[model samples]
Target: MSSDELTGASEKKGFSTRKAFIFAAIGSAVGLGNIWRFPYVAYEGGGGAFVIPYLVALLFAGIPLLFLDYAMGHRYRGSAPLAFRRVSRYGEWFGWWQVLITVVIGIYYPAIIAWAIRYTGFSIDKAWGDDPEKFLFGSFLQAAKTPGPTFDVVPGVLVPMIIVWTITLGVLAMGVQGGIGRTAVIFIPVLVIAFGALVVVALTLPGATTGLNALFTPEWGALGDPSVWVSAFGQIFFSLSVGFGIMITYASYVGRKTDLTGSGSVVAFSNSGFELFAGIGVFAVLGFLATNTGQPVGEVVADGIGLAFVAFPAILNEAPAGVLLGLLFFGSLVVAGLTSLISVVEVGISAIRDKTGVGRVAGTMILGLPMAVVSCVLLGTTGGVFVLDTMDNFINSFGILFVAALSMLALAWVWKRLPGLAEHVNAHSSIKLLGWWRWLVALVVPAVLLVMLVLELRKNLAEPYEGYPAELLGVFGWGIVIAIPFLAMLLSLLPWQRGVDLEDPGSDQLDHADRTDEGSLR
Candidate 1:
């Protein structure tokens, strides 16, 4: 039976409208990374020089892969797990592993979102002075360095995590249109407008050059290092959320016969544009602050979470309308984090709904409850925080790679047995695939992913940057980073051995079941 039939025909409503899908894509792409990770990577990779590789990666690798994903999802008309299984009978089990990565991301991601929410709330409390950085830095570090109810168990972090998760779960429980899809359309644009305004204001701030110089003045020599390439590839993968199976799940919602190539292109372009602008805005502001305060660039860089927690609060406290600016910056962050978290949760939600007969609400709560527990534990232990960070980075960076590989293999090799595969991919595509595009998918994409996997391994195995930890956790983290996609590919071949019908969506008929009948507790 088709997914429509499996849901007893009630779930056969048309897919998300174009505008809604676009909004969701933007929401997924513009997250904490745009504000936090992009600036740091840009500065570390030699400013302007980093821009070249970033743009190159986006154009050649990111965009094409996005189009590829859209095509695959639209063709199968199912979630990632079912979609891949539809492509090849053997690849059915690989979907859960992809979902697993998203679950790991969801665990730590909310904690960060909670931090943003807490910061935004602090803006309203007026607890911060014109020179809040002093208090912000001291408080956070003191809390990290010291153990007591004052910092570790403080409501500042814990409350926000709970609240953010509550709101996120509530929205998700509402389903796509009432929940995920609708909320995205509203917040994604607001996020962009707020971020754009903050950038404009940040540029005008006094002594902003320190941040700009550190971000834009590229040391060309740095580009030659192999690590730079690896970083670029890693950024491309993570920024697009390519390998995580998230995109595939999202694209599955697109209406049948939608222009996969055009929609994918728009999403990729929008995402890359957000990252680029954010890099310029954030680093420039930080550069200015560093120069004016006479603080070393290295110091600012070392304080990863502290950049948002300490530095930005300090910078805002000094501005003319500092509190308002803080509100905008952190408010946008809250929205961004929420949108990203939605995507992360959806990956697992899709899996549970498919593999079992669980409703979306039950799946989301089942998935989220454990994360809440983990976050609470992380709050209690310093080492737990590092472990969470490592898991997120390793899974996001390498996990997605494996997902992407499995996806490509399914479409290119496994799905070749399907009837009219090319015709299905091109059904609603605006630009017809040329003969060359087929070869590119069959050869080029897989080759690029393989090369990236090797480079990532070499770089991780090489000496850690000065002062960086080289312990067992760190090494294990690196290993996971290298193993995620490779293992994904290996796992993609499993379902076939179990005698599952991987070539048809009917194999997972329950995936399309509506949870509304399960009651709210679901």
Candidate 2:
């Protein structure tokens, strides 16, 4: 074990206060998914009826698993790799897997942010012109005619991407308190305020009720569909940012006395609440678009990059205050996406610092520079969207969900530490988690995730996703999905740094020691 590990003193870099930690955690959870993915997924799953399964998933799988992550990180006081390593020598690889997934996400996610940044400017002049779809795909992106590995870089996209990288690296280099914590404080409130304003304005639009009716008119029959239930669980899992090692890494900064359960609940519900809020605004605007275009809301509703860039811009063009509204919409995306990008890169940053003992500035530059360069170079190309779409599907299914399932299994089954971890959480929190929480984390969450994985795999294998080319799916899609875990396991075989301890029991032991010391004092 390393001297620092032996002394338990090296892991001192943390958020300056509890509030900063909460905001940062919230920033991580409320990302592009909240804005882009949730509403569509909710709509497709069961519309208004989906809320029931979603809430059930949150209580049963999302929050319970979130508690597990916080417990692991707080108890171990380390990034995912160190935290998992402390559990078992082999556990470190899972941590690396999570970190690797973050790296992959980090590569392409910022490119979308770049698009948002450009669109924010375009919103000022309605530069997207009459045909927003043609402008977005042809004029701005110069998107490939087909889904292939073509590399025609667009300067418009590349330049903004450079700016995005510069901002991301700068914030990350400032260390946790000055960089992430400070940024979160500013960005999270701004995001909520801006989005809140947008929602209010959207509700005032002519077809707001029509949009909302489409969103909340629950198809009760959807509740009976197993796919709707699966979709709910998937949305909760991805939306909360649990399985990706973000919560674990973020919680590693907490003090021993920090209230894990209360803070976790706040983070969990805050993310969900924001999703619901965003949905209201999103569907409201879509309703307006449908009314303006004389189309049904279903015909106009879109998701992911399409919803943000293409459909929304087209909708804004028809608005009375198109420029101002467009600016606000895309600006919100830029802010939300940037905050998320910060959290995603931090996973890699934290891992580097732990593994190499590098300071924050160097670690940020090390990973940030390469990630920025590659994102700009690759995603700036004509085929960038194709690659981004393919990679996203594969990673979310195999990379993130896979790691989450492994994490729960490792904690609940391999280490047999689920009950002990629950005790750790209850010991420090105002809200006490019951034994059922253990069963939920141990059995329920993993099983649901496993089934989702199988179904997704079956669907993908059955046919090309989105009708993309087979070669693109083979290389960028299945290729990345297969490579990540293999790389993680290989990396795990390497020796730990000299004096680095893998078995340091974290906050639980320290709490016990404190109580014992207090008894003696009494």
- Per-candidate local distance difference test: 0.66, 0.84
Which regions of candidate 2 fall more than 4 Å away from where they truly are?
A: 1-12, 506-522
lDDT of 1 at 351: 57
| Cα lDDT of model 1 by residue, 434-510, tens digit | 65566666766667777777665566457552224666335546665555556555655443223223344332332
Question: After aligning candidate 1 to the native by TM-score, how far in Å is the CA of 365 from where it should be?
Answer: 3.1
In candidate 1, position 338 carries an lDDT of 94
- Minimum summed lDDT over a 10-residue window in model 1 is located at 513-522
Candidate 1, residue 218: Cα displacement in angstroms equals 5.7
Q: Write the per-residue lDDT of candidate 2 for residues 1-522, one digit (tens) a residue.
A: 444342233223467678989999999999888998899988887789999999999999999989988988887767788788888887898999999999999999988999999998998888889888889889998989988756677899889889888998999888777788899999999999999989888888888899999999999999999999998999899888898788888887656778989999999999999999999999999999988878998999899988998889888888776776777788888998999899999998887767766677888888899888888777989989888989889999878888899789888888898877788788879888788988898899999999999999999889889999889998888998889889988877776555455675655354321110000100
Clashing pairs in 2: 1-499, 1-500, 2-499, 2-500
Candidates in order, TM-scores: namely 0.81, 0.94
lDDT of 2: 0.84
